[model samples]
Target: MTRYVALGSSMAAGPGIQPRVAGSPRPAGRSARNYAHLVAAALGLDLVDVTYSGATTAHVLTDTQRGAAPQVDALDGSESLVTVTIGGNDVGYVPMLFAAGLPRPVRRIPLLGSKIRSLVNPAERYVALEEVGAALVEVGRTLRQRAPRATVLFVDYLTLLPPAGPASPLSDHDATLGRHLALELERLTAQAAATTGCGLVRAGAASRDHHGWSPDPWTTRFGWPVPRRPAPLHPNAAGMRAVADLVVAAASG
Candidate 1:
């Protein structure tokens, strides 16, 4: 039987209200059923989930917390698969962008434009991306060292905001910024995968068509109320299933 290990942030941790197992402790409202669990089950592999909430690549590679293990320690020579989703929290970039109201068109810029111009210098963004890429490469190399035969898959971040809505005033800018940030992250992840000789899974491309009102079976809109809970930008059970399907296909192939 193949063993699989998944590493990343909250999305990998499955932060949301799930149907609680009778004896299992209920995770917080912010915790949803993430894609890793879904994929592991689909592949019938022994799953080791080492994902943490609010984790960046640096944190995953270094942090030690109860229930949240370091990505490096999860590796074993006998493991057959390793999947990683990381780098969003680095520099607190995503939250800064979103909280700065980049998700909303009007507030995004010149506020976002000015902030982007002022706070994160071009040199800084480049340097940060470089660091993120290097960390991913290290993660890949470490996984390979520990599990020489395992097929490593490195996943990029998803686009949390949907394309501009017709009714929204900031559609064009929102779309542009969202795509810009997502693409940059994708490039960094791709670079890491290339450096490490690991497989790259582009979540943005896979999810491009299904955002906002057109959410795939796996996602819900930002403000929509879910049964027994509410989650903002995370994937729901259906989304996890979709992620699982993609991962299983990749692993099986």
Candidate 2:
């Protein structure tokens, strides 16, 4: 079987998805049903999934996360395919959403509360777009160097907010800001793929109409995990399968 290595954050890891990958680090939230596994099954590839939850661009390119080595270290020049989905954490997407949901008084608590408060403070500066784009370009180039035979592709995050709607649980203000951030991430990710001559799986573009509030949601909205509620602010199982289809198409094309 051809070797395929997967890298990125929770968007690729699929936290709370059933049946965790055996021997995989629990902290990484390596779901057996994540898009990489689905794509691997569909394409009959030997998969090396090193995706982790809460990963930033730094985690992917250079920094260790939760005692694990940098995600890129999983490569060994023998793979035929590599898929990456990162940058959300770096841009404060999840952290911002999570902070928005906390009660005002709750945000005033110590330690974790302070961190959460900092994420949503309007005065705090987000990561620059160019820096993320540059990091992604470097990721693609490094992966190509480490696995020259592989087809490296950057899979941007799935659409989390509706194009035009009142994204519930999020204030109207936060909804709009979230939408803008998502678009920016998508734009830069595409640019990064182009910069490095890597293929792109257009998950964000294709899933725009399938945002969390849509009739058929690809992603879960911010809410408690009841039977009906999906994982607050992450891709759903449907999203994972759809992403796999996108990857299959990109890789095959």
Choose the strongest candidate by lDDT. Answer: 2
Q: What is the TM-score of each candidate against the true structure?
A: 0.77, 0.92
**How do the residues 1-253 of candidate 1 rate in per-residue lDDT, one tens digit apiece?**
4888888876566566474323332342223246776777677878777676677776667776455456678776888888888776764445444443434343447666666544334455556666776777777777777778889898776555565543132245444554556677888788888888888877767876665446353444445345654255666666666677777788888
TM-score of 1: 0.77
Instruction: Give me the displacement of residue 126 in model 2, in angstroms.
Output: 3.9
Q: How close is candidate 2 to the true structure, as a TM-score?
A: 0.92
lDDT of each: 0.64, 0.85
**Clash totals, every prediction:** 10, 0
- Each prediction's Cα RMSD? 4.7, 2.1
Q: Candidate 2, which segments miss by more than 4 Å at Cα?
A: 110-114, 122-125, 128-130, 225-230
